[model samples]
Target: MKTIALTVATAALGTDAFADSSLPGMTGTDHVGFTVPSVDEAVTFSQDVIGCNVFYPLGPFSGGDSTWMADHLNVDAKAEIPTMQLVRCGYGANFEIFEYTAPDQDTKLPRNSDIGGHHIAFYTTDMDGAVSYLQDKGIEVLGNPTTMTDGPSAGETWVYFLAPWGMQLELVSYPDGKAYEAEYDERLWDPRP
Candidate 1:
């Protein structure tokens, strides 16, 4: 797998790269998908804690007597999806949360340094208020909010926290914008409205 990934990465670094060759008509990220332990608990945490709106529910899908699951989703052939949901926090992309049951499933949550480690960051205008809110709710905040003092992210303040189910999340604020905005006209995608 590492060799295959290296080959693909090497190929991508070649000079054939061009703006026009990118996915046609692609706009931006639509949603991020992940499998959770429980859909009900995830929905509650997303809505009550993270301030997300639960859009809808889906699934209870299984490919019985077929290889559809493995062929399409690259999961175990006998895997079953009991519940799934779509949620939107504020202004950026939505989240597709799934609850799956499989024979070979690994329930361990990966750390940020692990191969598939990931975290969701939400934007806010008030860093102090946001951090206080999380703390008041009995959430396990990793550390005090940090304000970048140098480089491109000089004006940004951020902090990391953990969900009840151990998913890593972050709250970031850059109300006056970052230092990089002064150096370049192009900007990273801003979730703030």
Candidate 2:
């Protein structure tokens, strides 16, 4: 795969994008945390099904029965995270899965269009092979992958699917990189070596 580099002058991103003063200037992602109904099952799916490695053992944690917990996590102060475990997701972000129990926690899974409805997209080198593998494993692989026809993201392929728990997930692949990356000094999806 080939990647193109561009002059910084031509790549006109606003300075405000780098002006976050809260955490000693923003760096790359550390991890992505999400609550699951069962930490053990989530761990199994992540490791055995999704090919992530369990970086650590599950452990119990709580944010304490105070306004701080509720205000920050949007869960009841008395919420109890019975277990949590971290997993390394290939070359990208880590996953922080938790099994939480709270009086006000909603059991319904949210759709992508709903508020706070989100899906974690995993990058792959082979979109068709990945989709086929997932389908062979009896995973609910959604329809065929869609290739972008135009725009900055042109040349990438992606598809959406669901986990056993109904949480939406996505797979993305761009072996040749994207159109916008050619006009920027840095890249969001760097070509694999």
Candidate 3:
């Protein structure tokens, strides 16, 4: 069992396994897709609060009499997408916001501890001002901004908040860069322009 566990860990880490095989002509991420309870409401918040620019909107698609939805999107065959739109915020990856309808749809927002749970983090130079702005807009700011003063994350500050639909969002700032920057050549994607 120990040997099997080690093998699995090595495979997951990809230390040497499948080193040569990679996606051809691959580049950095272009966009991140997520479904929201209401596309219009999501777009409004993204635009009015987050300052995102909404791009072209897509159609209300259905699978009809086929299993195209299940086969292609891995969703229920009868699932439908009522509305979808692409949004660009700052210099990070664009967002593909979707509104889906299905018989088995789950409306509850998952906690960060749950599998497949996620949040969109925005970078800001003024963490305090951003938190105050959210509060002024009646947005739910989870707690005070946490500043990491030690370890690799030193010089970083972050706080989580919630969207009107209960989706998780975060504000992160590291104006002077994190401590890890000095120890490594490669760095995480910087949102600063």
Candidate 4:
């Protein structure tokens, strides 16, 4: 597997990204978090549009209102912390939704290059076919599905796309999974209590 260059950030601290996650039974690191504007809207898109399942619901009592943690615990009684909806891919992998009560403006994940937040990847048995279905639904396809001829994912194929609110997603078909294995390492994403 050929190594592809991935950017690594330098600063480190007890920020939200640095907060020690109390996710149960997890010993490795958590990669990223997704911040959205509304839990209800996020639920609609993820369930109706993305074809995922609700794994768990997150409220401030559970995960805390960082960005996706919408209403402050004291601000909105029902919304003590922001509400988080965890959605699962058809195959079983999960992506979480975080909708904080922020302005409906683009904050960080505007371009495809921001490397801090979460980017959910869905595994599709057929790559091109999946891309066509999404595009037909009026979703924004980020160019074409590129079959990697270089790097560890050399034989793997990926097509990038964005959710209506600008959350990034990927449709992927791996002819061989060596690259993904190396990258993800079978890491369990949810460990928080």
Candidate 5:
């Protein structure tokens, strides 16, 4: 495996080709958070079901923000609201999964049908294992891991699914992924190391 140096939170909040903010209630990467029905459930799926090695328990415990940016530059310095758990891929970026307290509730992304919206993607070396693990756990995949015939990833295989909390999640694999780390960018959604 190899390593890249961009801060997970920073890259997650950067501009895309169009330069519009792709994520809402987010800024400076770490400002992003996914509200799950249960923090423990979210942790299990990301760890055992998804085969990710858990990092600090319920961690980065402090210092993650979920406030929208006043300016695209970043979240406010004084921004502090709810707390979230940060997880990273075995070798890449970090993901922040938040559990609802009482006032907070699970919310939807802008919806893929709507513009400036999206789903979180997870990379897998074994797409079959990835699918099977989730399925065996009674987690149904929303759709098959279809092959992309479109844009930058004109020939990638991807499967879309939903987390217990209804947060959209995706699993993806490529033919020559051993060298995939070199092409890392703000778009790569990795698990916590």
Candidate 6:
């Protein structure tokens, strides 16, 4: 694990990059979308265990055998995105899950070091109870919970776990708040109850 350092200078936004005019009064995250091997299983896990509620379902969408989708979404134009479901995951952003049948789709889960590899982390009030519950339900927890010893994340405890389909997930808890939060007037949204 790496200890991320945050300083006033490091936190300043850089002005050298090409900047588009910001969207006026822009809101926060709308959703985080990801492709899944099976949307049905993803939905079941999210709803039954993760406590998300289905927003809606969409698709069987294609680009009508043309290059429209290839140019826009970078998918094969003839590919079929069989299903898409939006689900609200607690007080955080929604998840847009997809099931696609494409000519060049890769089903293997990527390592965190691989480009675009990522994991979704949920905050909890009790790390031990949460880990125990997931284990009893047969989910693969990678290791025991680790408590951060220093830096902004000190006092936090977290552990990585795997979904049934092998997509990585994490559970973190810091009921007393993190070291960095004390410096800010407003804190970021925490999933803890």
- CA lDDT of each prediction against the hidden true structure: 0.88, 0.80, 0.90, 0.62, 0.61, 0.83
Q: Rank by lDDT, descending? A: 3, 1, 6, 2, 4, 5
Q: Which stretches of candidate 5 lie over 4 Å from their true place?
A: 4-32, 57-83, 100-110, 149-151, 177-193
**Candidate 1 local distance difference test against the native:** 0.88
lDDT of 4: 0.62
| Model 3: lowest-lDDT 10 consecutive positions | 18-27
TM-scores for all candidates? 0.88, 0.82, 0.88, 0.60, 0.58, 0.84
Candidate 2 lDDT over residue span 1-193, tens digit each = 1212322422455455555547675744778998888888888888888899898856666777567668887778888778889998777678889888888889999998999899999888888889988898788978889999799999889999888888899999888788898788766745344
Ranking by TM-score: 3, 1, 6, 2, 4, 5
lDDT of 3 by residue, 2-39 (tens): 34564686578565543554875443478999999999
> Could you give candidate 5's per-residue lDDT for residues 1-193 as a string of tens digits?
2344445534664655335656654434443455665667888878877766666545322233433432441435333334456777556457766654332322555677777567878777778888988888888698778876656675578898876766677888875532435565535444333
Per-residue lDDT tens digits for candidate 4, residues 1-193, read 1011111221232234424557654433332346676778877887887776766786755324353233433233233325777776554435666765533434566555555555677778778788888989899999988888777666678888988877778887764553545677442332111
Candidate 3 accuracy as lDDT = 0.90
Q: Which has the better lDDT: candidate 1, or candidate 5?
A: 1
lDDT of 5 at 123: 71
Candidate 2, residue 94: how far the Cα is off, in Å: 1.2
* Error in Å for residue 180 of model 6: 1.0
**After superposing candidate 4, which stretches have Cα over 4 Å from the reference?**
1-32, 55-82, 102-112, 115-118, 178-193
Decide which is better by lDDT, 3 or 4: 3
Instruction: Report residue 183 deviation for candidate 2 (angstroms).
Output: 2.8
lDDT, residue 21, model 2: 46
Question: How many residue pairs of model 5 clash at the backbone?
Answer: 8
Candidate 2 residue pairs in backbone clash:
none
Answer with 4 or 6, whichever has the higher lDDT: 6
Give residue 69's error in model 2 in angstroms: 3.2
